[model samples]
Target: MTVENEIELTAISGRRSTFEGDPRPGDTLPSMKDSPAVEAGSTMTMTPGLEASRDQLQLQENEEHSIEVLPPVDGGRQAWLFLLGATYMEMLIWGLPFSIGILHVYWTNTLFEGEGASAITLAATLQTGLLYMSCAFFGPMFAALPRWTKTLQVAGLVIGSASVIASAFVTKPWHLIVTIGIFYPMSCACYFPCATLLFEWWHASRGFASGMMYAGTGAGGTIFPFLMQGLLQRFGYKAAMVSLGVGYVVTGLVALIPIKRRIPLSRYDQDGISRIRPRIDWAFSKRKALYLGIMVIGMTSLGNFVPSLWLPSYVDDLGLNKPNGVALVAILNAATALGNGLLGWLSDRMSLRSTILISCVGSAAACAFLWGFGKNSGVLVTFAIIFGLLGPSFSAVWSKIIHLVSKDDPAVTALTFSIFAFVRGVGNMSSGPISESLLKYDTMRGVIGAYGYKNYGILLIYTSITILTGGAAGLFFNKIRDV
Candidate 1:
């Protein structure tokens, strides 16, 4: 073969050349001894087939990892259904607790052998206090136990069931206090936080969802009282307790079965980190403190629940008797449920602060004008219906607090809830005592005095002041963006 032909053949064959010494001047070709590879930058190129194969592998890995870490989104249908189940469970749990009043009266009569209203009210007060106090640990515990959400829910069902069942067997106040007050709260604490996770799954409907959640408390109040009253009248406290406990356990289990973690376990720690540590926001920044202070005043003064517990007794004093009084309690709860639901929806549509202000003012007016000076049964009934309809408007207060802090700030939200709960707890603790003190005294003229108020008329005046204060504070709460 010719030299040029041989050189062309070598180039086409992709053979390397090497040389023992450096190339001579003007020599472009590399010797056989010197050559082992192609020119610079050539090594970086890949065949099109290999490039496509690598891309396919990367895409498969991405899809696999995504499926492993995240939950499948299904146009939010399954999520909404799960929310429904959660809502039902929340209603049942909260309702059962709120309905303890009738049981309180019956238990006092049957076991304590006491007819004093003050003694019976202590059970409710203690139950509320314990529930609120449990808030302190619930946030932290929930943050740490994201992996075991459903487990905590089941435990809540067990605790709630056992509390009432055990209370039925108690013969003393302490027994009632320990089981109903302490154990029930501890269990609820476990479940309430988990139940709130539904919020993460549904943002657009959160306000409506929250309203429905609270309305369950009202529904519980409505149902429990009537049920307990009837049961006590017929089968008595022990049988009633057994039946209620069984019902709670069954309902709780059913509701809990549908309660699931909307987010996959792998997605919980968002920053590619494993093992989430509990973080508490202790800063109590000026904004948080201002919001918290307003809540405290709202909880203690206007937003307090003194009248809700005592209104039935007041009806009795006004000659409404037991049946009508119980019915009135149902009416109040119905109103509360309706009001809370409506106002919550409105708050989301309009302004949360406005809803709060309007609710507080309406409640105050109802107390002062309708309830305070009602002349007869017709007037009193009118007051009861009106009050029930408007009184629960303030239920939007919680949504307001949540809005006042950003959704991403879980630590702050948890702390805010704790503070809110603690303050509200103090109000609940004092409500019975304060309302009782005012209504307990009877003057020669048949005027009743309570909480240093000389008459029921005066007691209404004081509550009006509180309600007004709450309204004013609520008005001052501007809508904090991005909170």
Candidate 2:
């Protein structure tokens, strides 16, 4: 008999049915709805075989219910709206932090004159680090309490806005750390996890959708630098910070309206008595592929923020006017936006490892060649655009990373993403101290060419090497599949 016929026979023999008609190949199978119901509140007992059959029927029903309830993936009004909301969230959560280069320029010249680069860079680093690190905690929190997502997001919006507003009143550098670094990132931990909701809404086009969402960061970074620069020039940093905070509150509230969970909380708690337990995938922690991927992510992350935090200052060091520096930062951000979308689309079409390899190798080349030797505004601008395009947008590969780490198991994807985020966070946090040490001493001075003799030679070489190592991890992609 054919496989289909065999399955039909097996199913028929497994269940004792009330139907009198002999089942045909194409006939609809008997459903539990046709079976006699246990009276309300009456305990029903059955043989072990019967109990197993009933449990199987219930599981099949639940699976069918889930399919029917989920919105169509990659399209439909609700799905697109959710994407739009997520994009806006990305803008507010990441835009300000990415544009810290402009603030670094302003503060060094005025508020924190004579302060070392490490102190200023620390706040920005903390902001970036917390944004990534918090994912480890918040990812699990959301998984455990999916119903509270909207509430937590709303709270985050308020806290983040307040933190920015508070930064306006800061009189010292540490104040900026508390407001911008600590409070803002704390709020981000709440808001950023909402991006995972897109997984529920889009599957086929998830990479594309995530790319579009992260493009918001690029959008924000592009516009905010210009905006903050203009604001600081005209109204001063105090007014500029306050205005951004107010703007975040107004815009964030509107964006939150469309954001929501795909599946209802009740669906996961069918009996209304089962406690919602956190599903921790400890086995994922033991996988060699996981560690290799983390190392790759960590290495790339070490240099990811170098340009964003220092490029504007580097422009100043080169004697470029403030406007030129601002413009360079804007160009970098615009290129980043393009890169995120393009790489995301590429991941959907090609092997994710290939896309990651391209980003790392290209970024390394830009840093070692274009950025290291850059001497004038023209070279700096070219470096910014190219490096932004190839380097900083590695976050776009996250969806692919999650897919690989989870081995295509949807249930563990979020936790895997969280773990990767934590690893990247550690790398980001360390980059601040690492950059400090690199810039503190100039061993290459007078020994190498003018480019290497330049103060930032150590920083550039370090960035390039780390990025190359990250790219080398791609060699093991085939091994990951074997695992």
Candidate 3:
């Protein structure tokens, strides 16, 4: 039978009509003409063609209905509130680690006087590393136990606070590693995965929301270094830790109040399955775009911590003194906050791959030129601001990557984010040791070239090269479409 005849037959049999080809946008289905009325209890037999057409029409309707039910993107009371809560949590969870440079300097000079940069860096590395890694590890937990999100966040806050407080009492660096580095990050992991809720609440503006939320880290980093410095200078490490612990309790309690899932917890329930069994998306894991994106993220992450952890120390090495160093770190973080919001907004409006390319290249330029030959404080400060503006906020791009990989399916997006987090964590976790190894050679201290130069020369060159490579990788993303 002809396609139109089949559709008419389906309609006559009381089933919805389907088109021969895909329906054009705004096109309506053909209507059935009036026919002789049949008896009330009589059933009409449908041909095979009619049955197929009806089934296709029903499937199309169902798909369209599903699209209609998704949450409204951008501006809404609930979306704004969710963003606010997520941002606050981001500040508390990621801020301290970003500002760990101040603590790193303090420990090197006073507490761990005999230790090398590599050993001391391990603490901050572990803390930041675990923070990123936990997102991968605990993401499934958040999805499975949606009802317990608040409880888990509270537990994380308490653990992190206690770990920081306990770290103040330790005399050895390893003790700090265990309490502050390991335990604190474990706590943050519990809170961080809750960020995935943004996927459920946003669509068109997902990149902007992710950027604003991650900007909290920049805000915290900007403010906390000074707060930490003043506290460390006046009250000492022990008092500073206590004050941070108290502050965490107050801020975390307030922030947790508004943070909630947009969808009902029951939606994740798999026939009342236990919350511990994580639902992994193996199909997503097999995607080339996912792995390629991860490679780009991981390579760029190699240099992510280099500036945050070492810039202050590098300033001190330049004989600039403490306040100058703190100012540079603060400037970097301030720029970071601005970059996160701006880049995120740009990603939403422009090409995601292009935005990433710009960010990576700009960061590389800052590292090579501003940082490489920055013998003076003014040059270093400029480098800090420019690099901060370009680097560090790369995490915001994950929102776009999620959209590309999962086609905006919330369940698939969550699992994909976890995998991305895991791969990025591997890069971050290795960065500490890699940075330490780069800084080992003091022989280049007076050399002329960028690579063969003095303190931090090799480190700067390595960072610049890695970031440039990452920018180059953006070209391949054209294969993925919209990335």
Candidate 3 C-alpha lDDT tens digits along 237-337: 89999989888878888888767755432222246653333344567777767877887888898876688767767767667763477788788888898
Error of 2 at 292 (Å): 2.3
Give the per-residue lDDT digits (tens) of candidate 2, residues 1-483. 111121221212222111112333344433333122211222223333333455665654553221122344578898899888888888888888877877877777888888755666677778878888988887777767765777888888888899999988877888778888888886765455555666666666777888888888889888887788789999988899899999988999899888875543332233755444444566777777777778889889888877766676677777777447678878888888888888888878878678888899998888888878777777777888888887877878787777666654323666777788888889888877788788878678764432454468888888888888988886677666632
Indicate the TM-score of model 2.
Answer: 0.80
Q: For residues 267-344, what per-residue lDDT tens digits would candidate 1 score against the true structure?
A: 223465555454444554566534744553555343347567766667776666543666776777777777767776
Point out the worst 10-residue segment of candidate 1 by lDDT. Answer: 12-21
What TM-score, computed on C-alpha atoms, does each candidate reach? 0.77, 0.80, 0.79
lDDT of each: 0.59, 0.72, 0.72
**Worst 10-residue stretch by lDDT in candidate 2?**
2-11
Shift in Å, residue 351, candidate 1: 1.7
CA RMSD for every model? 15.6, 8.3, 9.4
State residue 478's C-alpha deviation in candidate 3, in Å. Answer: 0.8
Model 2: residues with Cα > 4 Å off, grouped in runs: 1-69, 105-121, 266-275, 407-411, 446-450
